[model samples]
Target: MILEVLQLVPHPDTPAKAVPSVLCSLSWQDAGHWVAGFIVGAPSEALALPTPTRPARTDGLWQRTCFELFLRDPESGAYLEFNFSPSGEWAAYRFDGYRAGMRPLELADPWITSTDRDQFNAGMGAHLAALGLDPASIGTLLSTPMPEIPGAPAAPAQYVLNAHLEDPALGAAKTWQLGISAVIEEADGTKSYWALAHPEGKPDFHADACFALEMAMSR
Candidate 1:
């Protein structure tokens, strides 16, 4: 159940005059019965300007920037909030699970690297450690690079994931992964969370299109 970001069409009402320099690419796999997706971006050109301005009130800019994970229940949805630091070298995502009692999942240290499983595991351990999670207890890792989507630019960074987190409470371990992207921003802690939008059409899995749309808004 992997959802890939195949294409991104600008809103018809979007002024043709303002085109974005970057687009998003998304891919995912099934974790248990639920689907999990990773998103990355390909920059058409170097981001020369500051953050783009928010799109028209009609455009669903919020849905694009924020990662929404829909569960079996049609009414249930989990959101991973994204924020770009003021310096623009890092981006952070905070995953708020469906259940209100569950603590939010936060990933702040994001980087690109060769498809090295050991290195990726180490990085994931460090990332979790930063969040006060014990890495030693989280066990049994399997990872792979996301498949390339049609029309997406050559990926500047590769994404890899480690599934099966060991948790005694669930009788079975939970599945999760690490998604990396090209845009780099320093985590300054100023931006709280990315807003969610409900554009006219269905939202795609890719974050790049949403980020690009958000960037365009700043311009």
Candidate 2:
């Protein structure tokens, strides 16, 4: 699923009042894994990023510059939330229902690609070009290699998400609505919310069932 940042709600002090369009894409990996990639077409130039820290689980990563993924369980109505900060800080939270039973969700094999900014692009390019986007975000765990994406760019993308889970009911053959979004914070502390589809009213991502696409597990 590819979500275009249409409603880029920026703060009054936002550096880019009219930030260019941002594209966020998601993929489902073996059995129950997920990979989400985010790229900003507006400004590929380096923005003042938050301080780099060892990749670890930390809360409130979303309050600053971060990328997020939301997954809903059709059977129990439970949901999982993940936060990826450009600084290499990450966090995961699970809820029994909408805004309920909030707790840390242990992530297996979670990794970050933003540690070495210098080689970020080169690494991403090579990773995506060779393996395509399928497992690039997650690493090599695919039982069946993903088919190359036609006409995909040669350069590597900056932000991509990788996650995995195991569920018997919601199998690979069935597709589900995936939510992809980004929270950008400028040097001056201006914040903005971007996504493929934003519902009416405030910038709450939980609403509108923001199911941007019927994404399935495949190439």
Which has the greatest TM-score?
2
1-219 per-residue lDDT for model 1 (tens digits): 343443334343331222222223333222222222232232313212223222111212232222223211112233333322111122223334332333333332332211234544555565566578886766454344567799988745433222221112211223232222222211221111211222444433233223332110000
TM-score, prediction 2? 0.64
Q: How many residue pairs clash in each candidate?
A: 21, 6
Q: By summed lDDT, which 10 consecutive residues of candidate 1 come out lowest?
A: 210-219
Candidate 1 to truth, TM: 0.29
* Cα RMSD, model 1: 13.7
Q: lDDT of model 2 at residue 105?
A: 81
Off by over 4 Å in 1: 1-3, 16-23, 29-73, 83-104, 112-219
Clashes of 1: 21
lDDT of 2 by residue, 157-188 (tens): 34333322233333345445556677876555
Give stretches of model 2 more than 4 Å off.
1-18, 42-46, 115-174
Best by lDDT: 2
